[model samples]
Target: MYTSQQPAIAVDGQNRIHIVWSSYLPIGNALYNIFYRMRNSNGLWGPIETLSVFPNSYHNYNPRVAIDSEGNVHVVWEAYLANEYYPHIAHRVKTNRGWSEVVVLQSSYRRENPSCAVDKFNNLQVVVTTNEIGPSYDIVRFVRTPEGNWEGPDTVVHFNTGSRYFPEIVATPDGNLHLFRRDFGHYTNYCYRIYYKRYKILNYVILE
Candidate 1:
């Protein structure tokens, strides 16, 4: 029996379906970690694989995955830091060899609700919500360069009155990035509207 939480999916160049999700253990320290599995295009499901290597007592959830042009899998998830209350973004890559160690991506404040995509150039892009300034959460982005290095905590969108959450991204062949998020003005308001924006992939610089 397979049970999981916060499941995400992506497709590789070979059309193999890849999935990542969180799973909790019943015994010992009551630990939770991210698990990964894939289904071949030929109609076969592979073995289950645990991605996160965090120690016991920590939780890893809200996973998102993007498969690059080279068939390498990039995954990002949110987890509470040890001895800390705030949540941090964790990332890992699944190469030909196997899943790499989970790496914490730096941010000015705690991050929550993350999404990711791979551009035509095979560069990985991620978006998340952070309450860096005050009670309001802003949409921020992280990008991976051609050299396999990461850059930015770039501000994708910001609002003075409300908090932003649950960001998603999509990259097009023409080098365009489309970002979407949920905004809230106050706790009393549901908003119920989807906020959206589009920008050039090379530079997220606002036209203003």
Candidate 2:
């Protein structure tokens, strides 16, 4: 019954709507995978496409989609690979030529809840919750340069005893970034808190 969960949507300059979500199929080689579907500018719906690779042994979840300035569709999700100790952040991009191969942005740590956004310069930025540094989960950022180079898995927020999750990021026309996420165990009186962070883009790079 987990056929659809955590859906993400984006629209390109041509007015085409792109959507991605995680699905669970008990009979498949992999129990969970990410699926994509789009609505054309003419309002016609296209066939649903499966976007995850290595589906034979991977369970994918928490997908996030973004559309760059040049119309490339970027998708990121969390996946549990076979025999792996923790989940990884996987990414894929669909351009004029079609979808590229699935790339793992982070595999060394326990990561989940990936979020992504494209700046005005066409650089892609992704964020996920990871516990690589410690037992407490931290919000980590990864930037894919406009020239197609990957930048980081830098930890942006940390706490000795708390965790962060469900990060969301947005890039504005002026090249500014806005990030928000849920915080847990940070305060004794409250169960959770919503945190906000702002960043600036310089030469297609995110500044601290």
Tens-place lDDT per residue, model 1, 153-178, is 87888767777889999988888888
Local distance difference test, each candidate = 0.78, 0.84
Clashing pairs in 1: none
Candidate 2 per-residue lDDT, tens place, 1-208, comes to: 5668889999998999999998886435677889999999999999999888664447889999999888889999998877675899888899889998888764677889888999877888888888887877888888887777888877777788878888889989888989999988847345878889898878645686
| Residue 187 alpha-carbon offset, candidate 2, angstroms | 3.2
Candidate 1 differs from the real structure by a C-alpha RMSD in angstroms, to one decimal, of 2.8
Provide the TM-score for each candidate, comma-separated. Answer: 0.88, 0.91
Off by over 4 Å in 1: 1-3, 26-30, 55-57, 186-190, 203-208
Best by lDDT: 2
Clashes of each: 0, 0
